[model samples]
Target: MNRMTKTALVVATLFSASSFAGYEVQLDESSKLTFGGYFKVDLRNVNGDQAYRDYWIGTSTYAPDTNQTSLQAKESRFNVKFTHGAVTGFLEYDFYGGGGNALVSNSYTPRMRHAYIAYKNWKVGQTWSTFMPLASIADALDFGGAHVGQVFIRQTQIRYTNGGLELALENPANATDANQSIPDAVARYTYKGDFGQVAVAVLARTFDNNGVAGNADGTQFAYSLSGKVFTFGKDDFRFTYNAGAAGRYISPGHNPGDKVNTDGSGDLLTTQAYTVAYRHFWSEDWRSSIYYGHADVEDFNGLNADSDRNHYAINLIKQLNKQLSVGVELGNYDADISATNSANSDYIQLSAKYVL
Candidate 1:
């Protein structure tokens, strides 16, 4: 009796599985899709030496010895989103990739900004790094508004979030001789309240490269603190502090957590970065923000070109309509690198945008 009963159960399970495999699945009307992003054009007037911050992440920025003015729309962006049940996906692109070829003078090329999927508190694909907090980023007209203090990084990762805690394993870029196979690791804890949120994030990365400058394989540690505070109606404050092997988290190849030495050893460079900003709303359609950012990198060698810099900016924006806006920002930049050839610059930008 037992054997025959079991046999019948197994046959039923097999028949059910085979029958279901032939069926088709589709998203119902409840599922939704949308496209968005803004069309933006920026006009800039620049005065200063190199080390002046420009568009995007400020990497590979020109250090022209003279002042210049330019107009470009590289910040224009577009994105697509899909939502079905508990799963959501997003894809975003912007034209700021700087395809610096002799051709395409317009520099209008698409670059991936974000591409990821989220399901029930889990995220996968390329997005903001876990070692950085998005809540502290200021709403500035410039592409790299939070230049000095922001731990700006985006990479492929697997992440999980519960309440105020998040953890992720992210892709790491290594070009040295310490060949390794492990990914970068990061964790963060956020505390949210009625007024604002405070988050602390930490990162661990392996540095194994060409062994150049007597550098060897090793591990580096980094951390950041980011927070936001509500002041008045429609007014708020934002700040961020970062330290350690900031690596690409601060800016690609700018100042890493460690410097390779001639002794075939690694020296941990102590770098500190911070930014403070305050935003005020004059009316429902007008607002302004004042921000200051500074980064100081310990010079392990006399030739390091990324030792120190400071940034100051103020922006005034007017919302012309529900789908369009115009803004102007003034910025001052100062850099003292390698204790030599210091430079100072001032910049003003006018931006207009149409949203969709």
Candidate 2:
């Protein structure tokens, strides 16, 4: 195919809801191998007290006049897949394992992003949680476009999917350090059509404090609703809303599942998060996206109780070709700890990505 045809094909594939993309090889009549992933580099700077991170985590406190700038390629990753008959195995990794030095030779560790096996309608091993709506995620230059207001997590599980319904039993230990006597249960249903797609998922988990004194444990539930609606030509709107005692599932490291009370009783922190994003294609090679996220936590046991945070991001991306793209994003974040204390920060990021 010609270069223009190749680019168009790649773009169309990316916009599709399917997860199969990349180079493929036929090892035999019934066996196949695929290699995929992307190399991404980001240059970012943050100004103010919100603290700088590869992505927003809402851990910044009241520190003022803080500023930092850095460049990193840790977001680059690759994956391998092997398929034979009705069975498939996939493995993927990224360089977010930390322990890398910034002074010289930024050597970082590679961490597993996914490792799973699929046979028939069953999926086993580590992958994105069923409660997360991947299709509702924002499209932007930031590592996590709506990091502050989304359910983002990955863990080992056994899942079964039939049509639009999905059921899974995931590892609960990853969500809490307390004694876990049962796995996390999740159920999701999605509806897809030419117009767009929508999904709803529910999660149930048990938190056990190992009978420790002054620690409380119990069972809690969470729910999420997400969808992507196509609008005008090549434009779409995506959104997701999550609520309940989601804890780490709400937004890794930002919202905790529960807190210990003075009397040793565990209190499931109530958390709610939501994100809305819109993407408009200026042309076949140009596009722009804008997104906003908000998160709230209540009934906590600290001075920062009832804390909340919000963030906004906008970006313009240019597709150089089928395998290369560049984008620039501007974002702002704010945290409201209490009426007497609040902090905010602004950031700008430039990123380049190449599909392998």
TM-score of each: 0.83, 0.89
Runs of candidate 1 exceeding 4 Å displacement:
1-27, 51-53, 56-64, 100-107, 174-178, 208-213, 251-253, 256-258, 261-267, 300-306
- Give the per-residue lDDT digits (tens) of candidate 1, residues 146-250: 576678877899999999999999987544333446788999999999999999999887766555554535787889999999999989999999988655567
Off by over 4 Å in 2: 1-22, 213-216, 260-267, 301-304, 337-340
Q: Score each candidate by Cα lDDT.
A: 0.74, 0.84
Error of 1 at 278 (Å): 0.3
Which ten-residue region of model 1 has the weakest summed lDDT?
18-27
Lowest-sum lDDT 10-residue window in model 2: 256-265
